[model samples]
Target: MPLSRQLVLSLFSIFLALFIGAVWISVSNTKNFIEQQLSSHAQDTATSLGMSITSYIGDKDMPLIETMVNAIFDRGYYSAIVLKDADGKVILERRNPVSLEQVPSWFINMFPLSPPVRVTELNDGWTIAGQLSVQSDPGIGYGQLWDNASDSFQLILLMFLVGLVLVWFLVRMITIPIMALVKQSEAISQQKFDRVELKPKTLELRIIVDAINLMSERLSDLFGRLTNQAERYRDFAYSDELTKVGNRRAFDLAFEQILSDAEHQTSSFLMFVRLSSLNQVNCNIGFLEGDAYIKTVSDLLSEHLNKQDIDFTLYRLNGGDFALIIEGIDEVTCLDLCQQLIDKCNAIEKSEYESGTAQIAAGSFNYGDRKKAILEQVDSALTQANFNPLKWQAVDKLQTVQSNDTWREKIKALLDKDTADFIAQPIKSFSGDEIYQEWFARFPEPDSKQHIPMAELIPATIRLDFSQKLDELLVRCAFTKLSSQSGTVGLNISRLSLLKPSFQHWFVTQLTQLGAQCSHLVLEIPERCLFSDTNNFLSFIVNVQNLGVKITIERFGAQIASVTHLRAIKPDYLKLDGRFTKNIHTEKDNQLFVHSLVDIAHGLNIKVIAVQVETAQEAQTLKDMQVDFVQGFFVGAPIALEC
Candidate 1:
């Protein structure tokens, strides 16, 4: 119960008790006073009548005695008056009728009042003639007593009710500040430390309000400090000290987040960047000049990409290589962005610097599960660019490693039979702590005791339009097994599933069923597939996000143009392309580019993750770059552990 209600009830209870006691005392006193007055009047009337009727009674004049008695009875105060001679014979008798309605029978029965009577001895020349008796009507006294008691009771009840109402109002007013404090406390417990504005006149309430405000201010300051610390920690882990783009770790984390956002939204693109002849520049000109060249490219990309509504982020994956994850864009826009970036890279002029050449290769994919295929496509495009020595080139199609129909059929059969299983690979924090595990689907056949990667099966499922069913089964199995625990698990979605509304609906329904546990599931989509249809994909992602599931973009650096999409679809994490992390430390130019990329991503509060790290030195270098998390062979190889 509210404090006001309790206080009001208590006050009313006390008032009722006191009112009842006072009413009882008043009724008793009034009844006694009325009885005394009636008795006194009856005694005086009888004495006077006895004096007047003495002569008549002595003479045996019964009529005269009766007349005197009748006179007194006619006054209506007495119900009856009677007289008798000394010989005990009745001298005169008179009676008046009493109305039953004037005083109720039940009340009369409960409090029966005897008529007040008085007698006087009449002497005729010093001798007693007869006893003169007089009585007053008890009904009159009863009526007066009832009236007085009723009035008093009514007044007491009215006062008590009014007093109760006043108490209720007063208590509510007094406790308002306390109620506000309680609400504010609840908000603080939820991590929303907003101050209450209620000002209380009560000294105790004022003190409490002041204390609450002080505590809230202190907590807000603490949270600010924590956010700053987290940012600095990110800088240390993912940023390249030299060029300030994403270091390998920063690149990986940012790219992964961007890719995840794209896949979830189904509307983002990627840009894979590589510096040309960084080795030749360092060999001919000095390491310092080579660093300047990398810095030049980073500055150009950052300046052009940092615009309003452009979801673009630059990341230095490692050593002369940088990646940009753009969101909220299509293939044509991404292609244009790539061309612009390449044009800027080509325009750089060197003074007293070694003869160096810069080449740009670009590829765009509609977001899908074919991350490896997208990367290979871009690589093949870059290889084509390398052969031509062109200023700018674009890959016409994203390449896919064709798997045999037999493998596709086997995987489809496993999924249909509900025999598909998953292996989880942990994505670890820099401190070697496990944050979450990426879920990898597998099909184990009877003859082969070992599990076969679902990658071979997933591509065929996409072609067969059965990817959504496979995705649903995998999600159900994973959730059924792992929903009991609290941790993030990654699930890969096929490109074809992105176009199916049923697939989106199923994903959303499953997430809703998980409820609070939905946070444990991380849905990953390939960055290339996101560009297939940006609007529908974005809506689908937003709907699922409303259900509280985490979204991630996979293979984030395949297209240079998709960086524009990042602003619109802010992902939770970005996984950098493995190619950038490979040989990152030895490549100085790539290091500078990766550093710049990390800076861009961190500015937007995105985290970076480096993939495929193979050495302790490489991990340390990534750690120094301020990456949030790392996943590679050096850190921990992907394993087929169950979720």
Candidate 2:
């Protein structure tokens, strides 16, 4: 029962007990008082009647005496009246049998009144003529007592109902603060450090609430500092001092990270824009002007890349070189973007610096291509671009998406059908025991797994607004898997599906039906989902967490506000980005970044998961850093879908 209901019931019980006691006392006193009054009334009637009948008693006019007695009896107050001669012989008697019509039989039995008799001597000329007696009617007294008692009971019942209503209201008023405190405590347990703003008027509750607020503030401050520390570490290690873009180290890791994704499309390229006249500007204009030239080049590249929907990364590879890695861009589009940058930078060089100008080049690289080979190709192209008037060149690169009706119908058919299934990849501990199996939902490709159709279907899922249907299909498969199994399974949910109102309602309802099986399920939410619609995401997190489902932030460490959001969310697992886990043994910068990140997550009691770990060296390095979980091919490739 709710606290308010319990308190109301308890108060009502006490009220009822007191009310019963009060009613019993009132009814007893009224009964006694009525009985005494009836007896006294009978005594007065006997004396007064004896006086009046004295003259008749001496004349021995029996008929007249009877008439007088009958007159008194007819009034209905007395039950009986009797007269006797001075010789002790019965003379005349008048009696009236009295009964109360309004009083109930039950009340008469429960509270029976006793009739009282009074006797007085009747004297005629100094002689005791006869003895007159009168008996009081008990039915009359019973009727009066029943009426008073009935009225009192009705009044008492009305007061009790009103009192109960007041008690319920008061209990709710008192429990509101308590309920707030409970919710606050639950939020804290989930690692959300928001303070409780309600200030209860009760002295003890106010004190408790103040204490909780102080603690929450202190915790929030601590996490804020930790997040700042982590972000500072990332910035200092990866950010270039002059250009403020990612350094060469960041570029290499990002390159490896994108290629590491087996799901990455085959078409990719690396473009390098060089400020060929930096030396001339430094020698003649000024070193400050040379630095200004580099900054301007970096800014232009960043602005262009940020505006595009394409996958790209900006890095200051050297004092004169800016490297950009773009994926899935066709040859024409790549050259167009490169040509635009060269023209824009050359305009600045000719107008202000009067030094040389800019040269741009890009080269295609597919998955599994060597980094050195691709770099050589792009650099060689840049050398040729310097000789060309256009000042831009590129190695062969072209790939276009299939957005025809057949492709759309193909994707729609997959979503509408039950051909999609889940494949499990183990997330292991340092000792190699399976901690969890991250499930991948894949719609069966007609050709092979190597040419998975997600590259085409993914855009369809988003563009066609069918992400919710896809997610629902996978979620149902996951539920079936959980029901038949005893192991933990993790499934990824689309942010789009989570945002849909119908999907959200269905998901929550399904979880309630799943009940205890929820403990074995983990939801892998993408790190990007945290930023798109934060309030809804937080509410979703709280709701699922309350229902005992675990949340994992997948593809972690790609966002700007990662640390702060992670602290606020306090998810059970942070699935580290593949870049951090790639070549970690040989990469000191990545190692330091991963180490610091692990410490931060550990401080909050959240576990870290390093994903896409391919090599043994990478796994060993991550284990040394105390990463709680590792998931990738080296740990175990995804197995066949369970039926």
Candidate 3:
């Protein structure tokens, strides 16, 4: 119960007890007072009548004696009045049975009143001539007692109401500070430090308030320091000194990081921007003018990229070569952005800096889990764009690895119709125990047996705005496949689907309906998506995990800048990108990276899974690195589960 209700009930109970006691005592006392008054009244009337009737009895006037008795009885105060001779013979008598008006039978029975009969001797010239007797009515006294009780009850009821109001007010006042403390504590749970501004008047509550305020202040300071440290580390390691954008070191980190993240590995755009003929401009004008030209291009790229609201990283690889990695974008949007960059370059004041026109080249590809491969491909695309800078052939070199208009239409039909074929890849741990089979969707070519890999098809789904529908189909099928199984089945969710409201609702509802099967399911999310709008993603993760599904970060080391979120989210598993595990035995740098990644993940009790383990030597290296799970062709290739 809430404190306010408890207090009110407690007060009401006490009031009820006291009121019952008071009414009982008041009723008892009133009954006794009425009884005594009735008895006294009867005695006085008999005495007074005896004195007045003596004269009439002495005269032997029977008519006068009868008249006196009749007059007293007619007054309605006495139930009976009688005149009798000394011989005990009744000479005159008047009597009437009394009935009370408006008094209930129950009340009269509970407070029964019996008035005493009084007899007085009448002396006729010093001799007792006759006796006069009178009995008072009990009805009059009962009516008075009943009226007194009714009035007392009304008064008591009024007091109870007034007392209740006062009690509620007092309880509310006492609880105000307590409610404030509760709200402050709830805020702290959400990582928002807040203090109790109102000091309680009670000594115990005052102490509690002081403690809450001190704790909030300490937490606020600590979070501020940690956030600042993370930002400083990001700036020093990745940002270029002159441009304040990512330096070459930053580009290397971002490229490795994005490739490591399974979610961002595929369906991303990489744009390479170069200041064309800058050396000639430096010879014609000055080094300072060339620097100005680079700065101008940097500003243009930053301004345009920031406006897109997509997750992208920018880096200045060298004086004139710039690189951009934009995630969750379609080919057309990527081409449009490339055109915008080209326009900005063409619009650059060439005469002012004595610089040649700018050259921008862009390439789109589904990451095959290879960092070096993407770097080479984008570099080749940049070379192609420079061949004809005069025509500003920036958009021509933009190419997608598996995307064409025909492929998109085919993939769309497959997804919309839910007719895509899927294959499952078995993932085995270092202990040789199969953890789960990772499911992949395949779309057959228009007229050939060749099928499009998921890496190529997923980007199209995202670009086409129907990733949610495809994800729903995939989840349902995976659940159906694992219905009677005792082992876990894992599948990747579309990043685009995670961002959609309708998709989240449908996914959560489906998982709930899966019942026990949900417990045997593992879901994969790309780590790169955690860098921006993380609250929504975290909420999504929690909602699904609440249904007993395990959540793992695919390509765990993809975006190092947002690694702090891992501690807060605590995902069940972190899969190291395939690039890191490809040749782990011979590559010292890769081994070192895996060692650090495993250490961090273990510290938080998050198990690490190594991907693309191609050889026995690489698997041994991963085990030595303390990797918790391993997956590759060396262990086993993806095979259909025997249903």
Candidate 4:
């Protein structure tokens, strides 16, 4: 029961007890008073009548004696008045039956009062002439008693009502602060630091409020520190120490990830740039001047390449060597981009280089094959470029395996036919309880027997501007599956999907059509998507959440700075990127990074889920760090839909 109800019930019981006791005492006293008055009235009237009738009896006036008896009997006070001789024979008598009209039968039975009879001796000048008996009827007494009881009942009921109202008011006052505390407790459970501003007059409650406020402050401070630690840890692991570009480890991971995608196979290129005479420059110009020259070259390469208007990632490979990876470009465009870098490097002149300017070598290779083959080709091209100082060359160029028309036709057919099959991968809590299953749409690969991952297909879908259609299909398939399943299902929705008004309308209509089944749907978006156009993203999240669909952010650790934005629009789940999950148990930095991320997400009331968990040890470490959910091959492989 709620605190308010329990308090009200307790107060009401006390009021009832008091009211019952008061009424019982009042009724008992009223009954006794009415009984005493009736007895005293009968005795006093008989004594007075007997004394007055003595003169008449002494005179032997029978008519006067009868007149006195009749006079007293005419009054309604006495039920019967009789004047008799001493021999027990009646001389004169007057009698009336008792009549109680207003009194109730139950009341009379409960508090019965009978009039007393009194006998008096009438002396005739010194001798007893006759005996007189007088008794009062209980009708008037019962009537008066009933009236008193009725008045008392009305008065007691009035007091009871007034007392009950007062008790209710008091109970409400006591429970108001308690209700506020209850809400505060709920917020705390959700990892929110909501405070109780309601100040209760009760000393004990005031102390409790102070304690809760102190706890909230401490929790906020702790989470702030953890968030800072997470940002620093990511920077230490991925950032290059000198140039601030991604380090070699970061490059290796990103390269492997890109190569894993089957769709970008023939459209990506890797460029190798080497600065010659770096050792001679360091010996002559000192390490500081050499470092400055390297930084200048790195900045100029990035500036000119970005000016070319292409998608690329620049990384410093080693002391005097760097690499650039560009995607979705043809072979000729790739050669033109390498020439641009060579021209920019040749233009640089240093006044304090011992009269020698910087010499740069460049090479380009395809990114579709094995990492070793790609590196070997780029190195071979670089060897050729090193022969000619301050120039670039390409030893190998990636040939177009298939035309864009083929990709467009294939994707269009899938979108038109809506025959794309999806697989479900289960994500479970630390306790092994199934929370939901994440759905992945399968795409046909070049080899007929194999299928490409959703990650690989998404880039092509975005390139073709068919991401909206893809999202619609995914949502449709998810809803169809969820309509019959008893568990929840999560679907990944692209940022492009929300950009289209038609897709938004379709999403709303489908949710409405699904009705209650929509509750089982969870939509996940990349965290990088929220970094841009935050207002619309938040609005979109709110709109979907209002329809009972949950929202989660996948690949959450890409930009650690974005966590600050989570406070305003907290998502239901913050799925840590698989990069952080790689070798987490053995890598101290990865463990710390994940721990801090969890702390930050929890502070914002968002659940932390570790994806790509492939080992028992990794899952155990994640559980120890308080991650709420886990998803990967080790937990369960993706299963095709039965239907």
| CA lDDT of each prediction against the hidden true structure | 0.68, 0.78, 0.74, 0.74
Model 2: per-residue Cα lDDT at residue 216: 81
> Which candidate wins on TM-score?
2
In order of listing, the candidates' clash counts read: 75, 0, 2, 0
Name the runs in model 2 displaced over 4 angstroms. 47-59, 82-110, 117-133, 150-173, 259-267, 327-350, 353-357, 396-423, 428-436, 439-525, 533-551, 560-573, 582-607, 613-628
Query: In candidate 1, what residue range of length 10 has the lowest lDDT sum?
Result: 257-266
Q: What are the per-residue Cα lDDT tens digits for candidate 3 across 1-643?
A: 9998999999999999888778768988998887788778877888887888788785467687667778778888888877788898887777888788789998888777878888888887878888888888877888888898888888998898899999988887789888998898876654567778897778898998999999999977866565555455546655787788878865665566455444223567778888876777678888887787778888988888777756677889887888888876766667777777788777865665443566766666554457676667777767777676542333344555555676567766666555455567678877788988777755566557777555556656666665677778777767777776777888887666777778888888988889878888998887766765778877877898888999888876545535458756768889986656766799776676667677666755778998877789998988888998887677777665554
* Angstrom error at residue 169, model 1: 2.2
What is candidate 1's CA lDDT for residue 386?
59
Evaluated at residue 298, the lDDT of candidate 2 is: 84
Per-candidate TM vs. native?
Answer: 0.58, 0.77, 0.69, 0.73
lDDT of 4 by residue, 1-643 (tens): 8877877788778878877788778777877887788778877887898887787774468888787778878888778887788677887888999887778899889888867778888787767788888888788888888887788878988998998888788877788887788888776665567778988888988998899888987876776667767777777887778887767876776676555433123356778777665676798878997888779888998788756535566888898788877765555566666767777776785545443333333333333558887778777777776665535667644444445677677778667666556678899987778999887776555436466544335546656667778788777766777878899988877666765567777888888888888789888876766766678667766778889988888877765636546765668998887767766789787787788888877767788888778889999999899999998877887888776
- The predicted structure with the larger lDDT, 2 or 4, is 2
In candidate 4, position 209 carries an lDDT of 87
145-230: candidate 2 lDDT, tens digit per residue = 99889888888889988998888877876898888888977777555777778888778888988999899888878767777877
